[model samples]
Target: MKKSLELLEFLGEPVSRDMKETLAHGSRQFRMSVHMTRVPSINNVVLYSHWHEELELLFLAKGSALFHIGQEKVTVRSGEVVFIPPNLLHSASRLDQEEIVFYAVLVHFNFLSSLENDQIQQQYILPIFMQNRRYPKLITREMDEELHIYPLLEEIRDAYQQESLGYELLVKAKLLEILYRLQKCAIHADADLDIGESRNSNSLQAKKVLAYVQQNYGKRITLADMAQHVNLSPAYFCRFMKKQFDLSPMDFLNEYRIAEAISLMETTDKKMTEIAELTGFCNVNRFTETFKNFYGCTPAYYRKAIRNHAGDGQHAVRCDTDLKSY
Candidate 1:
């Protein structure tokens, strides 16, 4: 039996307080899970740079986004899927004003190789799993017609949404099918594997800067402090951040702080003042003012709404959705 019911975590709740994803997606027996991530129109930074040790499959369920993965950027449209290999620094921003909604399936390679099934693992899984082979970054409906990729992704979504018995097996089967098709596609596809040195350097710098923000967001952190920590002058840092993230350094800091505060509101019973202080606001009024600026609602109202409708929010409109422990 595949016992895969873990905490249902959406992107609103950061897996950890840091830049890196720290949530355990699934149980130890089966290291895979799915999440519905939503980005509101007012969100300045749709997502902060974060990396985890799991292979991620992202299905654009509703709207489009400008996805920054490592050094390269991909504009992913609705009804598309993006394959993100493990340990890649990635972020997203709304392409237009509409909110971006997507479902992310986080899986570990060990789950595929865990059962040994050695021949397939050695021949097919190892190279791609090790990032030795090139793979397609974007898959469209055309690829689905040709390779049936989208159908499998839909099956994964259906399995996760319904969460019936044997859903784990269903998800695993679809993921393995997708991986096999990806390997074959790479063998014949003229995909570019060279992500470039500039991209690699940018990814490192992004990680460093974002991690610094995560570590020190509770304390008063200045632009000069962040720039100096990353060894770039304040002016250079501002330009770099604007070019890379499409947001000013100060705006990004506030966005990140608000995201953390949102998580606290969703997961904890802390008072608004305590939450604000914990997230680095000078006072409760300041926190509420900024929160309204970012989310378009008072902290108290937002907290009440999220708490009241969390089980049936935009992310969980389906009745069979297993939002256990949400």
Candidate 2:
């Protein structure tokens, strides 16, 4: 029991702070993680747009959240689950109420694959990973199969937390059952799956724009340059970006920069001016104003709050200021 607790503690370390990548060492072994997450009302914009090479399932146990998956926006309330496919850009924001609690189970397709010559890997798993099949992104308690699958999710979570002898085997079995059910549903609804080609094209273009911003956030970036990079006029580019992310290009850029600034504040003891410049705010005063506007507190106050809570090992910010608009 002591050994199990120690292992759980080791696995709880925060490996990924940025939105661009998720680094889970345990997931590399079994390619799966079942974890609980809480988003305070003040710090509601829990994650920025990011993509990973793992299938993600989110169960909302309490409260609500708005999720942006590619160009589609979904409002997932309590007693709901959302599935995000691998390599899809997604972000989440809390609803305008109390804190939100959710369970996230991330599974990489490689976890289920055997040797290269294995029939299961070649026939069933590879096609799902290759996007040859489509699965419903959201499943609510009202759905017909929820009674069958929700219990499996709970069992998996319980088996994971208990970590008894053969716990891993039990969890894997539950996951396989969930995937089989999802695949069966997908096959039945194959004819109704219509992810238009235009949406796909827009997603690709948005990814290009995101890459540009990520690479050049520290430097001066202009709307004209961004539009030219994607072969669109500036006016049209603004429309395209707003449609894709619900934020104009500049709004998204500022949000990304602020997110980077917050990361620096949490990880480093650098001066606010230095952090501002590094994150592309250019002017210290402007950075403070923008930070306060988005976070509902000055950067100095945020840093101090974080320092005071350092011993507790909890996040300092509790409320999200600008996320409600999205």
Candidate 3:
């Protein structure tokens, strides 16, 4: 029997608090999360650019969106799947419609190799984790439709939703199949692999700057400080950051701070003034204006909406959902 959409959880919350380092996937046992998400409009950007340790598979079920991966931007239309390796910075924005729907499956590589000396770990997992092999970043239905990867994704989704007896075992088997197929495809498409070597130096520098920001977002940080941290001139750093993240250094900093403020608002009961000070905003007015601009609501209103929705037993705001105990 086909499960109704209402039975599938819809996750549209903001980015995770530790998104700069790793996305918390809401459980330690399974180390995976599956979500069906909807973006109501092009202006509604669901998640900011962030990176994590989990491998991500995103399937575009409807509409179109621009996916920014490192220095590249690709338009992911319906029926396409994008594969993101662990710890790569990426984000998505609506392209041409009032709404876009997508399904995401995030899995820690360790989940696929439960035993320390598992054969899968030796053959498939270690190469990618040890940086000895590379995989393609995006897989379009137009190109890979004949490959049957999309069908496997559908199977995984249905099995996850159905939650039949031994569903975890079924999901693990499907995930292994997907990984094997991806490895085969990557081997055949070696020339087209979007490997990390191309952006090795830049990625390191971006990580450095991001780390500095993560540690010092509460303090007044200057462009010169960040540039010096990355050993680039301010002008060069600006261009490099723009090329890497499609946002200026200051813009990225503000966005990061805003993300932190949103986390504070959702999880803590701190006053707006305190939240502002803690998130590095100068005053309540500036914080309110910036919050409204990014989230389309004042801090107070956003809090109220969250509170009202909190009592609803059917749904909860979560960065990631674990399917092991569902």
Give Cα-based local distance difference scores for all models: 0.73, 0.72, 0.71
Model 1: which ten-residue window has the lowest total lDDT? 316-325
User: Candidate 3: what lDDT?
Assistant: 0.71
TM-score: model 3 vs. ground truth: 0.72
Q: Over all chains combined, what TM-score does candidate 2 have?
A: 0.80
- Compose the digit string of candidate 3's lDDT tens values, residues 122-151: 778876655456667778876676556777
The count of backbone overlaps in candidate 1 is 0
Candidate 1 off by > 4 Å: 1-13, 16-18, 35-48, 63-66, 72-78, 93-101, 114-124, 157-173, 183-198, 265-275, 283-289, 296-326
Error of 3 at 261 (Å): 3.4
Q: Which pairs of residues have clashing backbones in candidate 3?
A: none
| Candidate 2 colliding pairs | 42-318, 42-319, 42-320, 43-318, 43-319, 43-320
Whole-model lDDT, candidate 2?
A: 0.72
Q: What is the TM-score of each predicted model, taking all chains together?
A: 0.72, 0.80, 0.72
**Distance from true position, residue 63, model 2, in Å?**
3.2
Task: Tell me which of candidates 2 and 3 scores higher on TM-score.
Answer: 2
Model number with the top TM-score = 2
Of the pair 1 and 2, which is ahead by TM-score? 2
